[model samples]
Target: MMRSIDYGNLMHRAMRGLIIEVLRQVEEGGLPGEHHFFITFDTRHPDAALADWLKQRYPEEMTVVMQHWFDNLHVDDEGFAVTLNFGDQPEPLYIPFDAIRTFVDPSVEFGLRFEAPADDDEDEEEDDDGGDDDPAPSSDRQDAEIVRLDRWRK
Candidate 1:
């Protein structure tokens, strides 16, 4: 029998809603205690809005810390916007829900990872290229440890 529901998608949506709710609370009142967020997103996603320089720097993905430095945070159903400092220069970023790869709050050891949608136009031949493939970690992720939730899921 065909599965009656898309449980994975539903779970993802619920988790995304949790992030929104947390942001809403933070907006009303500052983070209580040591709460903070580490949000990683796909820079190449069409809905991601970032500075040209930032795009050039983090070509594939980028992560941002929403702690003591961010400002003008606005979250809507579709996405969120906030300004963060990059080398003493404040840069505004807009990231859609679809672009988010992960969200974590290390203070509480809470985290979630969302799978990015596959690109339909990708060439199959490009997958066979054998080259030096040392994965470069995102700069913001260096010190931000996250608790992954994959094992908890069936």
Candidate 2:
């Protein structure tokens, strides 16, 4: 029997906190060694912000890479914002924690997938992840071992 303690939610909080910590570190000292990230998030999330073109291009979801050239990476308790170059145009975006679908670091072959509850209740503030099941794979993840959190989510 599942306990009422809601360990799942706790774990989710921990995982999201982990991302915040990492980003904080990066914000302070910059990314270490070959450690870059592939963050896939829901474009339609209420708090997510992006350019009109980007939103239209990725109406459902979008993935961004943090590598050689990225700037203004600000991370707080709720989410993060960054400026990334797209075809020579620097685009800024804000991604909330719940909006993330997947977070992957191909260089270390580390990954995390966040999913909403099995029941589809879009109105619940604490019971949903902004995105769907469709994966947003990074080009570099082709050779890495991806970890999934699907079973635990169920």
Candidate 3:
């Protein structure tokens, strides 16, 4: 049996750390010219905190644009908090790092995709890959479903 280290998980953590660093910089001096973030996260994640109205609007997932007009931006080891305008009402949001699915900085054409933590039941299913009746999605199949950030750039 071959022992395989989970580099993918490690890379995910590193990328998440990068996201935190960028947010920290922005919190200190504000977003630089043409620099903004499109942060996509799973709304159903337990650590995700949002207004009831916003949750009703985005039941499954939500992408928040961190640009002008946001306030009280704070990032910590576990998660981040920011105030965004929803229908002209300032709404507070708290999202944990583990819930983030994608992070994109279109100005620089940079993006990172993360595999969200699987629920306990899903994790059990994933571990039972030995069953011949159920096959897991191939890596290529999963990649095909993800929208490439480069495609959005000129």
Candidate 4:
């Protein structure tokens, strides 16, 4: 068979691109209508930048709301930077797109949760797959841990 397209990775890129585009629009003219965003990202990402206090507070993943008040909203190819009020004290943050786990707009009830990239251990296991069979799908049990976007939508 010809080289199979890595749709999973492709989808991840597309989703991140969608976020970049949306943010760029907001950066230019502000959020339209009732739109806002809740972005969750890995604070541990190598390139993630935030106040050390914030990192100490949220050692793992952190979620930020982009509604109401935010300042200096700037977005580029890699990610975005914004200043948010944290307990009445403004703090600056720079989150890389690849570090984002979820991006949601509650007003529209739209949400997306990214899958964690596969590990080398899983790859080694797949090498023993029996011949004459299609390659198994790349996924993990954690992939099933989805964030329900909305109950009323369905």
* Per-model C-alpha RMSD: 9.2, 9.7, 8.9, 10.0
Candidate 4, residue 132: the lDDT equals: 15
lDDT (10s digit) by residue, model 3, range 1-154 = 8599666666766777788899999989999999998887767767789999778777767788888789999999988999998778999999888767678888887887665322222222211111112222223111101336753467
Error of 4 at 83 (Å): 0.4
Instruction: Indicate the worst ten consecutive residues by lDDT in candidate 4.
Output: 125-134
Once fitted onto the true fold, the runs of candidate 3 whose alpha carbons sit more than 4 angstroms away are: 116-147, 150-154
Q: List, residue by residue over 1-69, the lDDT tens digit for candidate 2.
A: 964775656777777878899999999999999989878887877789999999987777788889988
Cand. 2 TM to true fold: 0.76
lDDT string for model 4 (2-84, tens) is 59976766677777778899999999999889998878777777778999988877776678889889999999888899999
**How many clashes show up per model?**
0, 0, 0, 0
Taken over the whole model, the C-alpha lDDT of each candidate is 0.69, 0.73, 0.70, 0.72
| Backbone steric clashes in candidate 1, count | 0
Model 1 lDDT tens row, 70-110: 88888898889898998899999998877776788877768
TM-score of each: 0.74, 0.76, 0.76, 0.77
Please identify model 4 stretches exceeding 4 Å from their true place.
Answer: 118-147, 151-154
Candidate scoring better on lDDT of 3 and 4: 4
Q: Number of clashing pairs, model 2?
A: 0
lDDT of 1: 0.69
Q: Per-residue error at 35 for model 4, in Å?
A: 1.0
